[model samples]
Target: MSFSITLVIIIITALISWRAFQDNDLKYKMMFYPYNVKHHKEGYRFLSYMVVHADLMHLFFNMFVLYNFGQVMEYMLDFKYGSSLGTFHYLILYIAGGLFATLWPMSKNADNPNYLSLGASGAVSSVFFAYILWNPGATLNLIILPFWDIPAWLLGIAYLAYEYFMAKKGTSNIGHDAHFGGAVFGILYVLLINFEKGQAFISYIFN
Candidate 1:
C-alpha cells in the first residue's frame, strides 16, 4: 500500500476525533477505551487507538514522523528478518510503544480518572530511536534549532534526557513520559534481540 493510504487513514481519525469532541460525549476520550458497559463488550481496542489523534496538528506530526522513519525501517526489517518477521516486529514495537506510553502515565496516576491522552508520537519515537541504534553514526539536523548538528545516536540520547527531566518535574503539556518510556523500550528491545547480530556487525567492521 502507498504511504498516502496511511495518511488517509490518519485523516479519518482526525475527523472522527473532531466530531466526537464537538458533540461533548465524554465517551470520546481517545487514549484508553475508558471502561464502560458498552465498550467492555467490544474488547481490546488498543490497536485501534493508535490510529486516533486528538486534532489536525496531532495527526500531521505523527504521520510526518511515521512517513519519514517507518518506511525505511519497514524495508530494512523486511530484508533482515524476512517479510513476516519484519512486519511482526514493526507491529510489535509500534503497538507496544503506545501501550507502554499509556501504561507509564497511568501507572503513576491510576486513581486519576480525569487523565486522558491520545496520539502516535510515542510509538513513532520508538521507530526513530531504533533507526538511530541501527545506523549509529548517521547525522540528523535539528529542524527547530537549525544550526545544531549531532550524531543520530546522540540525538536520541539527548531526546531521552529531555523527556526524563520533563516527565520527572511534570514540567510541560507534552507527554514526555511516553517519549522516554518508548525510547528506552526501543533501544533495549533492539539491542537485546540482536545482541549476537550486533556483535557480528562490530566484528565485520574490525576485520
Candidate 2:
C-alpha cells in the first residue's frame, strides 16, 4: 500500500496538539507570536504554531477539514504529477500556505508583544481551497446550515469574503487573516501548477 502523507500529518498534528493542551508552556512556545519572531528570533513559530491549537474544537475542525480535502488533493496531484513530485507539491502547499498565512498577521502585530495565534486552519484552508478548484461543482454544507447544500465555488467565495471582512474588522481573536491568505495561496498554487485546471474551474462556474 502506498503511504498516505495526509494521514501522517493529521496524526502528528493531533499528537502535538493533544500534548500542548496539557502543557501551557509548550503551547506558548509553539504559538505564533509575531513580536517574539521579530525581536527574539523565534521564526520557527511560523510552522510550529500549526501543531498546536487554541482548543479541541479548533484542532478537530482543522484536522477534519484537512483529512477530507487533503486526501482528494493528494490523489489529484499524484494523478497529474506522479506520486513523488505530487507529494513534494502537497508539502509545499501545506507548509508554505501556513507560512504565507502568517505574513499579514506578522506584519500587523510585530510590534505587539501580546499577539499570539495557533492552529492548522491556515494549512487546512489551503487544502480545502485546492479541492474546490478541482471540484467546483461539489456540494458543501455548512455546520450551521447543514440542509443548505452550497456549490463549492460559491462556498469558496463566501468563505473568502467573510474572512476578509472579519480580518478587516480586527475585533475577533480568530485568525481571519491567515484563513484568507491561505485560501488565496491555495488557489494560486494550484493554478500555477496546473493552468488548465483554472480554465476548467472558470468554465464550471459560468456554464
Question: Highest lDDT: which candidate?
Answer: 2
- Which parts of model 1 are misplaced by more than 4 Å? 1-27, 33-48, 196-207
lDDT of 1 by residue, 78-169 (tens): 77898777777777776687666666775665555454555677777877777777776577777797887777766776788989999999
lDDT of each: 0.66, 0.92
Model 2 CA deviation exceeding 4 Å by range = none
TM-score of each model, in listed order:
0.78, 0.97
Error of 2 at 169 (Å): 0.3
In candidate 1, position 12 carries an lDDT of: 62
Candidate 1 is scored at a TM of 0.78
Q: What local lDDT score does residue 98 receive in model 2, on the 0 to 100 scale?
A: 92
lDDT, residue 103, candidate 2: 94
On a 0 to 100 scale, what is the lDDT of residue 171 in model 2? 93
